[model samples]
Target: MPKKALIAWGGWPGHTPEQSAKVVRSLLERNGFDVTLGEGTVMFADPKLASFDLIVPVITMSTIEKAELQNLVLAVRQGSGLGGFHGTMCDSFRSETDYQFMTGGQWVAHPGDIIDYTVAVTRPDDPITSGVSDFAYRSEQYYMHVDPGNEVLATTTFTDAHFPGIGGVVMPVVWKRRYGAGKVFYSALGHNADEFAVPEMALIVERGLVWAAR
Candidate 1:
């Protein structure tokens, strides 16, 4: 049987959640996973969320109910993979504790202009970062409060921008973590539709999706 994947998108339109989810779904489908794209919070609701090998949450900042939060955590903990980027995965669900625990990080702030910057691959040996070099983007440079034990795959050393206190900070641009029996992959990229269409960026997301689902 083909593996199943759920692509849940919503929260804020500013990040282009629907467009991003569509791009990601096409990528996953090309890789042989059966993909479903859903709108709004209904995708994250309980009873409809547990039947997939992967859950791709392309949502930005928002609040969700307690039971829905628990459902996602339990599903991922029991072996379903979770993969996303920027506020879609990290900066999302700020008021929810369970959501943060499952995601392995939270977007604390974006000091710079949320514009272009260089993302450097720190672990070239890792499959996700393999053959990938430093790349530039015209999107948000997310500063996250990441989990200590996560295996960092890539980072961006922040340079001076319009923001005064933003420079010289090392931020994880991409990473993977083991949560119980499941895998979690997050990248602080994909803040806009064009970023998702970037060649290397597309590969990074595709690889992260596959690796996390494994």
Candidate 2:
């Protein structure tokens, strides 16, 4: 049987979680995974979620209950894969301490309008990023506060499009972390449906899901 995948999308509608999740869900299905989607706040409530092969959060930013967080974190630590992009996985949970720790980073600011930003792949030899050389997108340049020990897979340089980018900044755009025994893979792209709609971006997201699930 195909591996099970659950995508929980919530937080900000401006970022269009539901729509973006559909795109991601499709990508997973195309790769032969059994996928499902939950809207708004149901992610933290599903008790059986821990049994799934993967968890993909499309959330932007919000506070989550402590018990809910505990369950999710513990599930990942038990070996389930967790993967997603943008504020959903990284910049999310402004007020939640536990949530922030699991993600390995937080989006502190995005100086300019959601314009194109260039993403530079750091560890090109990694399975998720190896074949991908460099790609640029007209989206927000994520200024993140990252965890020091993460296995960084990709990064981006800040240009004049955003300030506080002083002398140029090299920020991790994609990374993986081991929380207990679980594998976490995150991509700082996919701010919208169109972002993941790109063939290359979609492939990246798909590979990330498969990689994390392993």
Candidate 3:
């Protein structure tokens, strides 16, 4: 049987969750995954959440209930993969430290909002970033609070164009981690659906989904 994947999207429309969810669903489908698209935070409460091979949470900066958050954590710990990009994963569930712990990062700010920046692949041997070269990207150069334990695959440096006290700082752009038996993959890309068209950006996300699956 093909691997099953669940993509739950909603929360702030500013991130274009719905469109990005569709893009992710299509990519997984093309990769032969049996994909399910879910809406809102309620799906996190589903007892069957752990049954899937992977779960992609695309809700940005939304509040999840205690029970819902607990269930999601349990599911990941029990061995369901979690993968996402930009604010979809790292930026979601702001107040839930447990969620942050599981994913290994949280979005703090985008210094220059949308600007051109370089994404340097730090780990060329990693499956998610292999064969992909460093490239220029236009979007939010996310200044995040990331877990040092994360196996960082890509990074970007911050300049003093828009924010002070953060110049010349290097930030993780792509990382893969483990939460118990589950594999977690995250990329600080794709602020909107249009970014999915970027060859390098989309390739990383596609590879991440496959690499993240249980």
Instruction: Please name the candidate that would achieve the greatest TM-score relative to the true structure.
Output: 3
Better of 1 and 3 by TM-score: 3
Model 3, C-alpha of 14: deviation from truth (Å): 1.3
Please give the CA lDDT of all the candidate structures: 0.84, 0.81, 0.94
Best by lDDT: 3
Rank order by TM-score, top first?
A: 3, 1, 2
- Candidate 2's residue-wise lDDT over 1-214, tens digit each? 9988999888888778889888888889888889978875557667887888899888877767777788888888888888988887786678776777887888887778687767778888988876887887778778889999899988887765557434377888888888777888888887778777566577777888888884
TM-score on alpha carbons, each prediction: 0.94, 0.93, 0.98
RMSD of 1: 1.5
Q: How close is candidate 1 to the true structure, as a TM-score?
A: 0.94
Check candidate 1 and list the clashing pairs.
Answer: none
The stretch of ten residues in a row with the least summed lDDT in candidate 3 is 158-167
Backbone clashes in model 2, listed as residue pairs: 59-88, 115-138, 115-139, 116-137, 116-138, 116-139, 117-137
Best-to-worst lDDT order = 3, 1, 2
Instruction: Write one digit per residue (lDDT tens) for candidate 1, span 1-214.
Output: 7788998888889999998899898989998999988876667674856678899988888777777777888888888899998888887789886778778889987765566778888998999879988888777778788888888988888766655676798888888998888899988888877787687788888999999884
Give candidate 3 regions above 4 Å deviation: none
